[model samples]
Target: MTQPPATPLPPPRERRRLRESKSLSQAQVAERVGVTRETVRSWEAGRSTPKGRKRTAYATFLASVEAEHAPAGTVAPPSLNSRSAGRHGSAPLTRSVEFVQPPVRTAEPVNCPHPTRPPKTAAEAFDRLYTHTAPALVRQTYLLTGRRTLARESVERAFQLAWQRWPEVAVDRDPAGWVRAAAHEYAMSPWHRLRPSHRRPEAPPADAADRALLDVLLSLPPAYRRTLLLYDGIGLGLPETAAETEATTPAAANRLLHAREAVAEKLPVLAKPERLHERLAELAGAEKLQAPKSTLVRTDGERRTRFWTRSAIAFTVLIIGTTALTLRTAPTRYEPVPAPGAVISGVPPQMGPGPLSQADKKLRATLRGSGRGGPHRLAPEAG
Candidate 1:
């Protein structure tokens, strides 16, 4: 007997149609692609595209994937390097570039060769030292010399000289003492020079008492003031004071005596020695000390750079202008003047304006004469 027609299976949905066309299935493709069943469900439902290596390998495992349900692909697997190379082209730089960059360098201090180098720094140092020392060296120098200006000038000169020789003086037993001695020598030396012409000392302000004291100090000779300040103001011993001022011990003592006597003459009668030494100390204490500062030194490279940069800019501009002028294609010419119409005005208009015109001026003169009868009879002088 013929069996009843076998039950026809219902056609697969579009997803199944595509899967059949590509020979894939939800389970098989999912298994082949190593994705979850839910992911395959989403793909079949058109929710997402299959991604990554599994998509590339999808086709390879079609048969196994069909048995187990998986994705399909025909292309060979893509390597990581190949993928990267494909994303960004394998190209080289277009030009050979050279960049000029500056390098960092350690700073070097410049030496002020002359003993008379700017005392501004030493003066500052003296100011600092003056505050700390029992007897300020700066003040003592001024008091000793009876010339505050000279004293400041001398000490600063000495310090600059000594600083330059720091290597030699560095190992000295007493650097500060050496500097002090050098200052004294500088003060008394015939070589003592004036400051640069470019820089002049400002005049000291003179109040009454200060004026009187300054007059007294200035009145004494340099020698007497030097001895007094070095011996008494500075409280230096006889031999040390003598050594500083370039005088013998006895000579230093004599000058010291003279300094005191000179000062005493200007003061009220006070028998106590404290009165004199204290006054001397005060003078020594009041002097100024300036702080040190860096000074400029000449350098060949700096000079060359400065010179060439300025010259190069000027030369470049000049060359460009010359080239532009040479390259100009047109030339200018002056045109000749034209004669005027009719008999012609006396002056050509092109020659520029003149008293309206000679003819016009002459006509105006005739009209004025005719209006006045005779030019104007001189007006009678007012009584």
Candidate 2:
């Protein structure tokens, strides 16, 4: 006889719900399913689905979990074994297999209702995102840079960039995350070191423990520091932290490990991950890092855009005018240059009468004697 078709898995959301209802962590589920935690996360996130044996195993695990926690009076859906038993006139299996049916394939499109209303305008949507995300982002940036001014600047700049590219930002899976990454990159930029204002260090937190913690955090390499903040300070998953920091999962893990080790070495009290998370939260909360108003940010971004737009237009116009002028005035023909004057190769030198020799004296006397008749003789000769 052929084996029954593998039991169909529930929807991703339902899969996550069932796992959570059973008080299971992704790691625990992954351990049971012989996959990595990231794989389990992906399954729940709807990024990818399991296939073959993994699919059957995952379905079985979720089904058993649902059966255990399901209400007493609720009717359960039939499973493969249950269907088999019923075919043989045996008692139906009691376990609930009521996985939500997957959406039916259809030739025509269907318009499912959205859970929330869309924002009225792009500005309104951007403002809502900014208001919701900026405060927390500022604190996180502060933790990264250890400078309140830089943190606020970074967040504002990030939001400005997001607004500049609102279309892209609007469709992003995690807009807040996009802005956060931007802010983090700006705050951690090595260029900030060259700024005169940023040359000096910001004052440490007032509390000794906080100061020590912040010091230790700043002491870690920028990559390690960022990974630690994203993972421990902000409580992002390892995979998400890796993705945000642009590193391989294993590399992110290594950074986190080394960062934690460095912190624990400096502050033994925060050796535990949970304790470190708490301390980080406490440190961030203690600061008065407030983001600028969303309206101000939006307006500033608009103003900046306008300024640049006008500048670009003016620059283009100037370039066009200059090119036209050059074309109009430039000579069309080549002209040959006149050659420079040169001196004669050979010439006789004139001598003064006083410096002349005896021949010169006799020639002068003869010329004086003949001078009176020279004109008359030359005239007769001509006639």
Candidate 3:
């Protein structure tokens, strides 16, 4: 495999010349280079060398400065120190350095403008989507789970999934809807049951009526709760709610109906549409403060790499676990030993089938019946 060439660093003397040619202060150069003024001074003073991207930027900047400051009708010097008895070098040329200072506006508020340009890449699109949709997704998740941390976790996981599938997600007709569905799934996951609940049992409401209504709403099933939130709290239609929850329109409507009935049983005030919307708004709006900042997601290729790495690790662990368990639980085999006196001196214990013939079997049976008598004499007395 071939390796790419590394970027070249500018000579120390060349760096000082570039700063001077541009009439830029060390502070300005430091800011542009994203380093401290002392670092830039060290580079220019030959005490240290610029490396990596910093060195490349220094070289590129110097080239541009030379191009801009070169005098007309005269070719610029190929190198900064190539001046021995040169015309301009011999002459005492003085250049005026202007120090432009502006009044400090520390007391004034700063307005950061958002980028309005269209995204040209999938990464840019993902960033834009995170910035715009993170708040709403978090709030929606909070409304479903009634837990701030869980809501943030769900939204983050959803965005992570979106990032892994950015190729599909970036081109989807309803990217936000796709993310919302993921968040909802995460918020209602059974995995949460395995973990001890560290979050608040329920969110505090704005008023008594809202509190009672919220208690009842949280008691309902996750699907019904989400349906109510999307349909009424956020003012989304049944079709959109169904799409977000991955349910049919009729299913969403049925859930909405049941959710309303459940709420009405606790607080009759919720039976009224206006009252219900008001309470729902209050319940959902309480979560606005808890919406978390959007997170960056790994790209599709990176996700694939991680997936394979995790799979390999899991397989190795599985093999190790199987071997350990087998070793621990396998039955042990024991060889049979003869009785202490059963073996005669210098004779091996008989392990084969014994007394196969009728006469031998009858003789063995007679010996077994002589348990209380002395060993039978070999001589046949009565027979």
Candidate 4:
């Protein structure tokens, strides 16, 4: 004779109760099923009902658990709110259980150089580039300009320019290099040179000698100052420094060598490479330059709008002013008749029209004779 069929397992809630009653932790059950404890929790809480193999696995585990605790032929208790509980008129063995799925989580995409898709707009790309590079750029700029305000202004203005030309900037192989060069140019702008400094701010110094070294560094020509900063202050190689400053490797190396000599002449304490690097680091820290907030950087659309608006206004003003000037200074075809008294010729001035020809006089006589010298006539003769 065949054996009787196995009893069906109760719902998810009852299964959990049965497991807890048996003192089997969710971990043990999860390990048996090859899923996470959280997954097992989801199964038991009914937030996510298992399907196919997972369902089968869960039912089997629950059945085994129930069988192990309770004797054969005993019916497991109904789960909370299950139809079986109401049909059987059986009170819940325990208080009602509630199931809530943990909130579904989504990972935010990070902006990085190697993202699967490039940033949607040039502004996004530029901002990402700025976020990653601005601090180091400011530090380098501070080293070059020797003035905190000037360095900060240079970096900000360079970023603004970068935002304006983001399309070109976004695709650059070395976006930081481009920004560095731009900041350098801004730091050394003739406009900045023309303005005299009211007072020189003191550098952050290890001692008196560090301040003297910085002063000498600032006193060097812009080219030498920038080369030394990139090579030492920023720790770029000779070729990279050359590329940043738009100089050949040999020229950058030569400038760096001479810059070291100049610094040594001014401050004998920093003549050694190790000594110079330490002093540069001290200066970089003292400047305390920060990366500008991304929000402070305007988007590509805003920059484009401002540029086009200014261009249109300028073009309109130029056109209007040019028209006015052309009208004012333009040469005329004929000279004005001399003033009444100033007439050089003895003949009377021909103010209105020259005297009518003898033929014209005859024509007038004929028109009057024909009664055509009235306002209705088409010719002046009518008047």
Measured by TM-score, the strongest candidate is 2
lDDT tens digits by residue: candidate 2, 1-383: 99777668887756765664443556779999999977886787677999888998999999897676443322121110111111122112111111111111111111223312455788867765775467667777888988999999999999999999999999986687788889998888899888999778778889998898888888999999998887666545666667889998778888988998999998999988767866776787788776777788989999999999999999999999999999999989998899997667676556565677999889999989997876655344553
Over 4 Å off, model 4: 1-120, 196-209, 299-308, 311-315, 321-383
> What's the residue-level lDDT of 169 in candidate 1?
55
lDDT by residue (1-383, candidate 3, tens digit) is 99566666556645654564453556788888787877776676567878778877776777776566433211211121212112112112111111111111111111123333456677656665665456555655676776778888888778887887788987776676677778888889978877777533644756776566667877999889988776656445556667778898778878988887888888886786546766654555554444333332344336666988999999999999999999998878876787676546887866888648998889889978886587756786795
Looking at model 2, residue 382 earns an lDDT score of: 50
- What's the CA RMSD for each of the models? 41.8, 16.9, 25.1, 26.7
Q: How accurate is candidate 2 locally (lDDT)?
A: 0.71
Ranking by lDDT: 2, 4, 3, 1
Clashes of 4: 0
Report the number of clashing residue pairs per model.
Answer: 18, 0, 0, 0
| Candidate no. 3 TM-score | 0.49
Please write out the lDDT profile of model 4 over residues 315-372, one tens digit for every residue: 9999999999999999868778876656577887668777999999999989778785
Indicate the TM-score of model 2: 0.61
Residue 172 of candidate 3: its Cα lDDT? 77
lDDT of 4: 0.63
Please give the distance, in angstroms, between residue 120's alpha carbon in candidate 2 and its true position after superposition: 1.8
lDDT, each prediction: 0.47, 0.71, 0.62, 0.63
Question: What range of 10 consecutive residues in model 4 has the weakest lDDT sum?
Answer: 98-107
